[model samples]
Structure formats: structure tokens, C-alpha cells
Target: MLGQALLMALRALRLNLLRSLLTMLGIVIGVASVVTVLAIGSGAQSQVTRQIRAIGANVLMINPGAARQGGLRLKAGTRATLTEGDVDAILEQVPQVRAAAGSIAGSAQAVRENRNWNTTVNGTTTNHFVVRDWTLSSGRTFNATEEAMAGKVAVLGSVVARELFGTDDPVGAEIRVMNVPFEVVGVLSPKGPDQDDVAFVPLSTAKLRFLGSAGGTARDAVAYILAKAVSDEAMARAKASIEDLLRQRHRIQDDQEDDFKVQDPSAAAEAQRGATRTVAILLTSIAGVSLLVGGISIMNIMIVSVTERTREIGIRRALGARGRDIRLQFLCESLVLCLAGGLVGVVLGATISLTVARSAGWTTVIDPSAVAVAVGFSAITGLFFGLYPAHRAARLDPVEALKAE
Candidate 1:
């Protein structure tokens, strides 16, 4: 009986195909808007989380002082004031610190025979790889003895390897730093372009041999300390301890803010996710306005539809059809219109998401849940907007409706 009613309603839609399509336009736009906005927002959130996870969980950074000073305001491009001693103090004094290493960076041109490539030269110790979860593909990292001796050896980042050696194995190859030869000990695994555009050497070797001094070039230390916490729960305590220690060590007054800045990865991830969520809500809310307009269009179309179908309603009622039955038939017609439009809109939204992801190079994660919501809302909009027109049709005087026709 329900199937027959549905088929009959579908036949009515086919009879006035253009009218049905025009009526469903609002639903189509409403559903598509909801889906595309949410998909893009969710994709941005996922991309941010993935990048943060790659950096590591429960991570924090203590960068050098703010670019300010008393009577001696430092301009941009000034050297960092952070030193190796500060990192050592954090390792020794901060209770929750599990591992820590200091680092320095400089830009230099690396040359191997006829090949020359511009690269960032990083100066750090062995534990840098361990803390960063880096793997060496060949040879070995410099031992404490080699570091103490300030040996002229280097590690090649993946891109540097490709640039200098092509397909050949670069381990044991000789690469020059500003024309001074240094033996390549190993190649770091591919860890993405940002981390793979550099060369690595012991801090002592880089400062003494390449950078022009034994007591660190320009009498400046370039140690960027990266530390891991003992556990996730201990990260907050670890960060607090490091901050307090640096403040006291720097002799920062209570009224004055600490010069050094420490960043926590887990905390930063949470904050970023929160901001993304807010943006999603704001975007959906604006899309909701489009949906509301769609609902109004549905109501307007249904009212016109009811008038056009009045003669049919009159004939059905004259043949012993109840007012409620007439109402159900009209309601079903509207439901079918919006429901079909919703399905089309879902496909449209998915296509839009996938196209944007491929062309714009954004990460698009389509939430299946969002499809359900959009479709369900479309159905509700159909019923809600169809109600008044259905009621007006049901209350029509059959004889009067027939006589007017």
C-alpha cells in the first residue's frame, strides 16, 4: 500500500518534471553548502594535527629572547642570545626532562668535486638524532671522541645527497665546506623537504673549523635546545620547571615577562584544534543562513504546487478520499523532491572536496557523518516547509475547488 502511494507520488513528479526540479533547487544548494564547508574545515584541522604529530607529541621549545632590550633595542636579524649552558641547565635541573640536545644553524654552500649546492649547516651533537627519532642509513654519527677533537666530518640531509651525488652512495664521500674538505660520514633518511635541506656536523667542528673560531664563531653560541618530557602527564611540569629555571637564571624581575619563550606541542595542538573547531562552527552557521533561505523557497514552491493540484485533490476527495490522505500525498511529494535533491547534493559536495584536495593540494577528509546530517536536514526542511501548504489543501471545499477548475 505504501509502495503504491510512493509510485503514485513519483508519477506526479514526472508529470511536472520542471516544477519538481525548480522546487528542489533550494534543497540542492542548502545540502551542498553544508557539506563543502564542513569538509574543508575538517581537512584543515586534520592537516594541522598531522604536522604537529610529526614534530612529536608533548614537545616544547624555549626560543631566545624577544627582540627587545633596555636602551639597546636589537633590530631584526640580530643573533640569538640563547646559549649551550641554558640547555645544559634545563637537562640537569628540570625534573621531568628525559632527553635534551642543543643546536645551531648557519647557511653555507656545500661542494663535492664539480657539484655545488646551497644548504643550511646545522651544528649539534649525537643525541639530536635520538631525541628527534632520526635514522642514519650508512656510516655512523660522530662519537664523543670525534666531537671533542672537533673532526672535520659531516652528515648529508636527503636532498643534499640527491643534489650532490645523484644515485651514487654518498657515505665516505668528501664534501667541502666553503672549499674546506670534510668527510661525509652518513646520510639521514628522507624526513620531508623542510628537514632535508640541510647538512649536519658537530657543534665544535662547525664553529671552530668552518665558522672561523675555536671558542664559537663571533664569540656567540647558537644552541637551540630540544627536550622531550619523561611522559605525557609530566609535560606541563617539565615546561613549568624549565620556565622558572630560565627566569631565575636570567634574573628576570617578577614584574617583567621572561625573555625566553617555551612552546609545548601537545598544548599547541589542543589550542589549534580548538581554533579550528570554532572556525568550523562559524562557517557552518553562515551556511545555515543559506539553508534557511532554501527552506523559504521550498515553502513558496509547495504553496504554488498545492494550488495547481487542487483539482486533483477535489477529485480524490469526491471519490471518498479523506482530507488526511490528500495531505499525506502532498507531503510525500515534497519529501521526495527534497530527498532526491539531498542525495545529489551529497555527490556534488564530495566531488567538490576531492577536486579541491587534488588541485589546491589541500588535505580533504570527508566526514560520512556530515552526509547523513545534510540529507536528514533536507528531508526535515521538505516536511517543515510542506506542512502549511498540505494543511491548506486538506481543508479545501471539494465542490468549490471543482467548480473553480
Candidate 2:
């Protein structure tokens, strides 16, 4: 009985192929839109997760708050409220902290004989590498003597190495920063394109040769401090301990706001994921409206089909076909239409996602679950909207239906 109903449904659809195709357009578009948006969101979330992992887990960044001078406010990082002493205090007091380091940054031009490149210069201690999970690709990092003596030594990131040496080994070579020559003791492994365009020098070297003296009390201040927790579970404890310690050292009362800010790297990644999810939900909702519209179209078309087939339905009823059989045929028709539209939609959506990913150089992850959901939702839409029309056909009197033209 089911096979016969499905065969009749297919035959009816085949007779009006163009109209069937047009009716399914809405469902196709809605499903495609949902799939594409989900793919893009998944890709963005994946990228953010990988980047956070690459930067090392359980990391915290500390920066000074705004600075006030003569009743005017200065930029946040410019305040210089944090110094090497703050780093020491955090390490000594915060038992959850695995490693901590202070770093300063500046822009400088590097020259190696005829070649020159502009890159970011970072001033950091040996522990900065541990905090950031950075490792050398070749040669070696600064020794204790080199760091303490403020030696003229440097490490090149991959971009800097390529820009200056063009595939040649940068280690054991001499490079000049701001026209002050320094020996290249190491080359850091590649991080990413944006992160690799940099050079690292001993903190003392950066302070002495590049930053110079700020005069007065701000002389020893660093740009920021980076700390790593002993484990992922210890991040919150480490952060709290550092904050409480800094507040006490700065002697801020309960009524006063903190003079520094502590940031959790994982929080930033979670925020990004939340934003992506929100956008995906919004887009998918709009697409769902389209599917509703498509379902309405299916009902309208099915009602028209029932009207035109009244004589045939009457003939079948006279031949002992029950109302349930009539209803089943109409329901099957709706289901088949929706399933076809959904399949087409999946293909179209995947194609669009791949094209955009290639054209824009973006990562896209197509989830199989999204495809299944789209198809299932479409089937449900068909059943819901098709119910009333199917029942209407089933209720028609055989005698009256036969009396119609």
C-alpha cells in the first residue's frame, strides 16, 4: 500500500516537474544558507582555538591601567605602573604561577650589510620564552652571562630571517638594530605570519640601547608582564593572587580601582566563539523563515493537486480505497518534495562554502550534523504544512467528487 502511494506521488510530481521545482526553491535556499553559515562559524572557532593553544595554555597577560599626569590621562600601557619588581613579586607570592616574565616592545630597523628590514623589537628575559612556549629553530638563546652583561645579541623570527638572509642561516651573523650592531645568537621557529615579523633581544640590551632612560620613577617600568600557571586549573588562582599582591604593593584602598589589568587568554577565545555562535544563530533563524515559506508553498500546491485529481480520487474510493490511503499518498508526495529540495540544498551549500573559502583564503569546516539537521527540519516542515491539505482531500465525498468535472 505504501509503495503504491509513493509511486502515485512520484508520478504526480513528474507530471508537473517545473512547478515542483519552483515550489522547492525556498527550502533549497534556506537549507543552503544554514549550511554555509554553520561551516564558516565552525572554521572561525577552530582557528581561534588553535591560535590560543599555540600561544600556550593557562597564560595571563598583565598591563598597567591609565596614567594620570597633571590631571590628564595617558594611554593604558603608557602608564608604566608595572616594573620588573612586579614580576618578581608575582613569582614569589603566586604559588600557582609556573613562570613569569616582563617584556618591552619598540619598532626598529634592522640591517645586515646591504639588506635591511623593519620589524618589531621585543625586550625580554629568558623566562619570556618559557611563558610564551617559544623555542629556537637553530643556534641558541642568550646565556646567563650574555643576559646579565646586557650583551649585544639578538634572535630573529622566521620572517625577519627570510627578509634579511633569504634562506641563509641567520645564526652566527651580525645584524644592526637602529645602526647598533648585534650578533644573531638564535632563530626562532615560525609561529605565524603576523607573529613571525619580529626580533628578540635581551631586556637589558633593549633598555640600554633602544628605550634609553625615561627619567624619574618610571625608569624601570616594563610594557607588560606575562605569566603562566602551573596547570590549566590553576589559572584563576594565579590571576587572583597576582592581582591581590599588586594591589597591596601599590597600596590601593578598597574604595579605589585597580591600577593594573589582568587578562586570561582563554577568555578572549571563548568570547570569540560566543560571538560566532550568536551570528550563526541569527543567520540560521532567518533561513528558517524561508523554510516556513517553502512549506506553505508546498501546501498550496498540494491543495491544487487534490482539487484537480478529485475525479481520480473518487474513482479510487469507488474501487474501495480508504480515506487513510488517500491521505498517505498526499503525505508521501510532500515528504518526497521536501527531501529532494534538502538534498539539492546540501550540495549547493557545500559548493558555495568551498568557493568562498578558496577565494577569500578562509578556513571552512562543514559539519555533517548541520546537513542532517537541515534535511530533517525540511521533512518536518513538509509533514506539518501538508497535514491539513491531506485531511481535506481525505474528507471529500466520493459521490460529490465524481459529480465534479
Candidate 3:
């Protein structure tokens, strides 16, 4: 009986094929929109996390500012401070400090063989490699001897190397910086932008030969220090010690904020992850509304379908079909409509998700869990909205229903 009823329901839809398809249009649009938005949002959030992790999630940055309510806002009369002394103290006093280095950076024109390119010039000690989690890709980083002697040896980033030297090897090559000749000791690995577009030199060399000494008033000058903790267990203590020493040196009151800030990149990453998750959840929730709208469309169309089939219901009853049989037939019709739409919508949504992932370079994770949820909610919609019309169709008296038409 159930098989016959399903066959009949499908036959009804097949008779008006175009109308059925047109009715399902709302469901198609709703599912497609929901899937696309959620997939894109998820991809963006994943990329953000990837970018943040690339910067050494284990590293910590020592910056010159107090942490405010909204985080790192510079206001009028903000204490402008942080010094070489603070960096030295962190290295010498904090036992948890594994490697610590300070840096001052600026940009200048680098000239070689009359070919010039604008590049960032960073000045730092030999320990900078450890503090910044950098390793020599080729040749070598500057040694303590070079730093102490203020040697004019420079390391070229890959882009800088390619720009100036082409196929010729850059090691032992001489590059003029602001007309000051410096020998290239090594070429760094191609790290892309953010890290691989700069030129590096010993702190003392750049300060003496290129830039004049920082007189505490140079806003562009950095007394920035980076330190790696000895172990993950000691990160908290290391941060606290660095902050305390800087605050005491600056002579602030117990309650007054320090003139310096210490940032743990790991903590920043965790916070960013939390924020990304919240945003993804919100976006998914907003998209869920479209599914609800699709369900409403199914309900509206099913009610109209029942109204148009009143004579058919009366005829079935006159032919000796039970009321329960009529109810089951109507209920099965609703299920068949919704389930068919669900199958097509799922295929359509999945196709869009995969296309966006492949063409747009987005990460679309089509979890099996999501598929299950879509199918489950679709059946629930049929059950909830199909009940009333099925009941009304079953309760109609055959003679009365026939005479009314």
C-alpha cells in the first residue's frame, strides 16, 4: 500500500513537471546561498589562522608601550620610553630567557652596479637569529666578532639578491648602501614578503656608518627586543619578569602602567583563534535562516497542493479508502516532495562548495556532519508542515467534499 502511494505521489509530480521544478526553485536558491556563505567564511577564518601561525606562534615580542583597555592605543602625553638597558636586563636577569636580542630598523636605498632598490635595513646583534627564530638558509649569520667589530658585512634577502645580482651569486659581493660599501656575507631564503624583502646589518655598523645614534627622541627608532622562553612552562614567568623589570626601571607607581608592552605571540594566536571561531559560528547561524526559509516554501506549496487535490481525495474516499490511508498517502506525498528537493539541493550546494574551494582558492570543508544536518532538518520540515493538511484531507466527508466541487 505504501509503495503504491509513493508511486502515485511521484506520478502526480511527474504530470506537472515544470510546476514542481518551479516550486522547488525557492529551496534551491536558499540552500545554495547558505552553503556558499558558510564555506567562504570558514575558508577566510582558516587562512587567517594560517597566516598568524606562520609568524612563530611560540615567540614573544617586547614592544615599547603600555597595554590599554582597547589594546595598544597611543594617546596624548603617553610615556615615550623603552631602552637598551631594559633589553640587557631581560637577558641577564630573567633565567627563563633563552635568547634575547634588540633591534632598530629603517629603510634606505641600496645601490649595486648602479642598480638601486629600496629596502629595509635592520640592525641587530648576532643573537637576533635565535630570538627571532631565524636560521641561515645559505652562508651564515653574523657572528659575535662581526657585531663587536661593527663589520660592514650584510645579508641580502632573496628578493634583494634576485633584484641586484640576478644569476650571479651574491656572497662576497659588495653592495653600496647610501654610498657605503658593504660586503654581502649570505643570501637569505625566499620567505616572501613581511620577512624576505629586507637587508640586514650589524646594529653598530648601521648606526655608525649609515644612521646617526638614536638620541631617545627619534620616533622611528626602535628599542624593540625579542626573547624566546626557555620552555613552554616558563613563558608566563618570563613575561612577568620582563614586564616588572621594565616598569621598575621606568619608576612608575605600583598602580601606574608601564611605559612598555610585552606581547606573547602564542597568546595572540590563541585569542585570534577564539575570535575566528566566534565569527564562523555567527556566520553559520545567519546562513541557517535560509534553510528555515526553504522549509517555509515547502510548507506553503504543500498546502496549495492539498487544496487543488480535494476532488481526488473525495474520489479515493468514495472508492472505499480508509481515512488513515488518505492521511498516509498525503503525508507520504509531502515527504516525497521534501526529500526529493533535499537530494537535489544537497547536490547543488555541494557542487557550489567544491567549485568555490577549487577556483577561489578557498578551504571548503564539506563535513559529513553538515550533510546529515541538512537531511535531518529537511525531513523534520516535512513532518511539521505536512501534518495539518494531511489531517484536513483525511477528515473530509466524501459526499460533502464531492458536492462542494
List of clashing residue pairs for candidate 1: none
RMSD of 1: 3.5
lDDT of 2 by residue, 1-405 (tens): 989888999998999999999989988998898889889989999888877866777899999888888998887765668888889888898999989988888889999889999999998888888887888999888889987888999998999999999989988999999988899999998888877899999888888888653222566778889999999889888989999999999898999988899999888988988998899899999989999999999999999989999998899889999999899989999998998999999999999999999999988999999899999999999899889888988999999989879
List the global CA lDDT of all models: 0.80, 0.89, 0.75
Better of 1 and 3 by lDDT: 1
Best by TM-score: 2
The estimated TM-scores of all candidates read 0.83, 0.85, 0.72
Instruction: List candidate 2 stretches off by more than 4 Å.
Output: 1-11, 213-219, 253-256, 314-328, 351-364, 387-403
> After aligning candidate 1 to the native by TM-score, how far in Å is the CA of 250 from where it should be?
3.7
Candidate 1, 264-319: lDDT as tens digits: 86677778888988988988887677667777787887788788878888898899
For candidate 2, the clash count comes to 0
